[model samples]
Target chain A: AQSVTQLDSQVPVFEEAPVELRCNYSSSVSVYLFWYVQYPNQGLQLLLKYLSGSTLVKGINGFEAEFNKSQTSFHLRKPSVHISDTAEYFCAVTPTGFQKLVFGTGTRLLVSP
Target chain B: EAGVAQSPRYKIIEKRQSVAFWCNPISGHATLYWYQQILGQGPKLLIQFQNNGVVDDSQLPKDRFSAERLKGVDSTLKIQPAKLEDSAVYLCASSVGLAGGPPRETQYFGPGTRLLVL
Candidate 1:
């Protein structure tokens, strides 16, 4: 079975500041990684995904993540954040041959003015 | 394109009562999934359907929770004799199915139904 870990429960940052949400996974086989964001009352929206190419994956809203195989990490980063970027972020993974998507607890990004 | 759709944004029911939630996947999506999300936790897949056929349901509480995706488009999930622990958000998501890709297809999600068990 595959599992995801998001060490930080919450990350507070000011507007226009850089931020990074850490994520790690454990899997016996190769896997795919993804980052999703959820607004207050909406469902999750895909921020980006890492399937097979380019360890550095860029996503919408100026967000990006790096797939570090040796470190088993896929950390999401943004050069600058806006107040509207405040939302719950999630990291998910699925094995190369499986269909089940395992998600981390979540990291709430709180952006202040 | 329209995303996944779910009905009854919020529902309140007492323990031992029954309630049901509805979901409609994207027009051409062949795979649908139902997930339960507790407060402060990530969503957990309770059941998965591939064109009206059961694909995986190992985590579902079969004794009280049941779900069906009829016609391979719309689906309904029901919980009988609800428990206080059942108070959580129920999310519905859909993907292009195995034919599109394996472990790579993006799963679009719905607004989710918030169930409150008192």
Candidate 2:
């Protein structure tokens, strides 16, 4: 019963442009993908993960995410963005062995300048 | 190193009163977590611990919520009576191993505690 679907609640991008923060998931089994980054008050950090190797996944400050598994999706890219990169972005799912995670309802990232 | 530790970063209480929150982890981290963010949503896993027992708390809300980690590296989370949807933001995380294993560890957060149940 996993679920996550961040279709962008807000994304104002501008500091250097180039951003993408969309995510989708539904999982029936076999899953483990993440991307987190809260900033305002803090708590939540870990910007890359896709356990099981190689679907892109780059994380940390530079940010990157791919893992498309037939379009279940896991988007979160950033070719150029700064202004501190703003914050608030989440998309999680866990089901491989279940560490329990199923989030997705965030995507602020308002980095203007 | 020194990452997960939370305690009253902010609180405002007012609906039926009663509140408590505290956490400290990341020194070997045997796994610990408690989340509940809700100001826009995303972060919800009320309880989970593996060092002091309790593998998962289902969804936590046992009557009015309550948590404890006793000796597994400090932890507490109580919320009797309060409800304004319980306000939000109460993260605390840690990770190292031992909970169904396989080494996927990566959960280190803590700078949250903003509860305003008015």
> What DockQ values do the models have?
0.80, 0.24
Q: Candidate 1: where are CA atoms >4 Å away?
A: B100-102
What tens digits encode model 1's per-residue C-alpha lDDT throughout B16-87? Answer: 999999999999889999999999999999999999999889999999999998799999999998999999
Per-candidate TM vs. native? 0.98, 0.34
lDDT of 2 by residue, A8-77 (tens): 8998978988899999999878898888888899898888888887899887888899998998898989
Q: Residue A2, candidate 1: how far off, in angstroms?
A: 1.1
- Count of backbone collisions within predicted model 2: 0
Question: Candidate 1, B39: how far from true, in Å?
Answer: 0.4
Model 2 interface CAPRI class: acceptable
- By summed lDDT, the worst window of 10 consecutive residues in model 2 chain A runs over A93-102
